[model samples]
Target: MRIIPREEWGARHGDGRYWTTLPASEVWLHHSVTVAPDTVPPWTDDFEAIRTIERIGAQRFGSVYGFPYTFGITPAGLIFEGHHIAKTGAHTYGHNTIGRAICLVGNYETDEPTELQLDAVAWLLRHGQAQGWWREARLDGGHRDLTATACPGRHAYAAIPRINARATQPIGGGGASPSTGGAQRRYLQEESTMQLQPGKHGQYRSIPDGATRVIVGCPHGQMSARIIWHGPGYPSTHDMDTRWPDFDWVAKDAVHNTIHRLRPWRVPIPEKATGFALYWDYPPVEGHYDDYTGEVSFEF
Candidate 1:
């Protein structure tokens, strides 16, 4: 959990060191997507990507004194200090005062994070909580969730829980981050199968109170099964809000059969979420489910 100071990293704007209060309320996750993930990984390249980030920060928001995030994590699992928890950081725009941001190096959309990277990020979070940088060390969500940009990238965004879970290490052993809104251990635990029909109003399954992962499994495999997410409002199956054009009853396996060889289609969802529903829909696409049924599986 050692963080390389800016001085050690040869930061150009390390002069104006400042401080804030302890135990930040929110932890914002981000990814340095600008760097080609394979452009020589950090294990040997030192902090070149970090330097690029600092250069970009200097160019975009000249007023900001130094790097935006409180910390920068390399793919090699190195933690570099930008701004300390008490110090005001330029990340997360208006939320800087209360939020501590950690930017993971690489574009996770195309690059799957390495185990070392994940473990390092988790260690940082856990260390923050254990050291009293933040009381609960709440993970407010990724930068994309708070703003318009896809900052953290899809793969990095999906690993938030794993980060939280790994950061759940015992304080004596290492560090800790904010637990996922009090969920000390958030993992993919399967739930019972839920059956949903097309365009049914007020017809949704009741998931457990904590956040969950939704997987649409099509035992039928790659047929005419398509479904979309339904929030607390439970939008109709055909609503444009569900991002569907026709009847919304498609299954998951059917959708991924082409690329994934019929792996269960995983639906992107919010962290620590509640009030959700699955809207079944069907489109003009070819093929049909073998069993004529698409099942929804819940995991947490």
Candidate 2:
């Protein structure tokens, strides 16, 4: 609930350009084009990175990037408020009129943010929802959808519906389809990262070919298992908080904190694991050598 004011949050671009703002009506989602490092440890925890984006936006375009209400998901799963919601932001051209924007750090074209980034974003969205920011808020759409430009990016824009779904679901009911009572799943798909898969001992099962899992134990130390299936009524990946409701498991020894040597592993894919949501960078994968190496197998 604590928001840093614009005066304190930004400075005139070296070009002497100032930031802009947008009136907040609904929460808009976006990807920051800052091209961040693959790993930010605890992203939101880094205050400088957040400032840098605004600085760049202001310098390049003579205005701060994104909307004032725009927030960002740090590489470490922390939510950071970029600008003031009541003020206008320079993020989008037309969409800024009725939307408060959220920009995820990192360049989607060149790199994907870590699990921490996703978690931070989801956290911010939920917070806004809890505060009734979206009760009447319409999600973000392209300038072309309303006016012009290919802003918000393709993949980032595609995630809007899912993002809205995660924000609107009923508490303790589970997933996007609350009425179905089906469990929602999230996937961790960064190049090199480890997540806890849902499975157990005596239940050797093939983790299909491509399923997403979470990191419950450690990064990658052989204490990993393929989640056979998730229980009905489990929360969606976006709704799952990193600090709260810690992912419980029957096989806890599989997740390892650190790996001896860097190697690629697929995120543990579990059978029947549908609608997998992924975090930004929880299970830190070495970007240089750990691209697309995340998974484990258990045959039942």
Candidate 3:
């Protein structure tokens, strides 16, 4: 992974005060919504573009908080160091302490990031883990996953699973892949009988002993789904409604509906765990939006 240091990018340091020195356990991906200043198509080189972004961020967030992220990635796939990882950023509220934020260069709601850019993200993650920067980091999610904003836009967010999978691959091909025997395949194909009542907050069910993955889906688009499990230390939760807006109504033909496919390898679930739970919440409505129905599939 090619990492461009702050010195190389001509970035200034913060005031020397840091929140803490703990390594990050989560990485949050985001997209810079700002466009270039004055050009025919509003395009700028990566260096100047990131510089502009930093200056703007300083002006906006520097007064109260430091730069909002630990790193920024350019369109050309070069990673730039922003705030030092030791300092807590204002990137994601309620999670700045534990999460490292990496903002991609451009808005991706309408535009798709290049393949090189996605590959760079994966490579950076792998590099961080190898360097012990975030050796305990296993969860890689978008900024919107923890917040209500449409950051790290839909197209960019869609690439997170693939990026995470690539990052977790063995360095020189030694790690074993998950087994997919006929029994396991049969478990995945088994239809879900669990039905979520409207306005229900949480539900729990016991999973098969050797289940490796949990697939959760909510067809009603307007609602949000979260899958939580009791593990060794504390309960861990993965938010499902990151890419789509909370209350936006979706047509039946919409390209992507709301779904959360929890791969235990990516989002770690306790090995000794027996049961898991599903928690969902939505905006209050006076009339009917859509009857909320969720399904959970466990793969053994």
Task: Write down the lDDT of every candidate, Cα atoms only.
Answer: 0.58, 0.42, 0.57
Ranking by TM-score: 1, 3, 2
Report model 3's TM-score to 2 decimal places.
Answer: 0.52
Tens digits of per-residue lDDT for model 3 on 164-263?
7766765522121112224112233223335444564777666655667655544333455665554322234434764321221111211222333211
Name the better of 1 and 2 by TM-score.
Answer: 1
Ten contiguous residues minimizing lDDT sum, candidate 3: 245-254
Stretches > 4 Å off in candidate 1: 14-19, 36-44, 172-300
- Look at candidate 3 and tell me the lDDT of residue 18: 53
The ten-residue window of minimal lDDT in model 2 covers 173-182
Q: What is candidate 3's CA lDDT for residue 9?
A: 57
* Model 2 local distance difference test score: 0.42
Q: List all candidate RMSDs to the true structure.
A: 19.3, 13.6, 21.1
Segments in model 2 whose C-alpha atoms lie over 4 Å from true places? 1-23, 40-45, 61-69, 113-116, 136-138, 142-144, 170-300
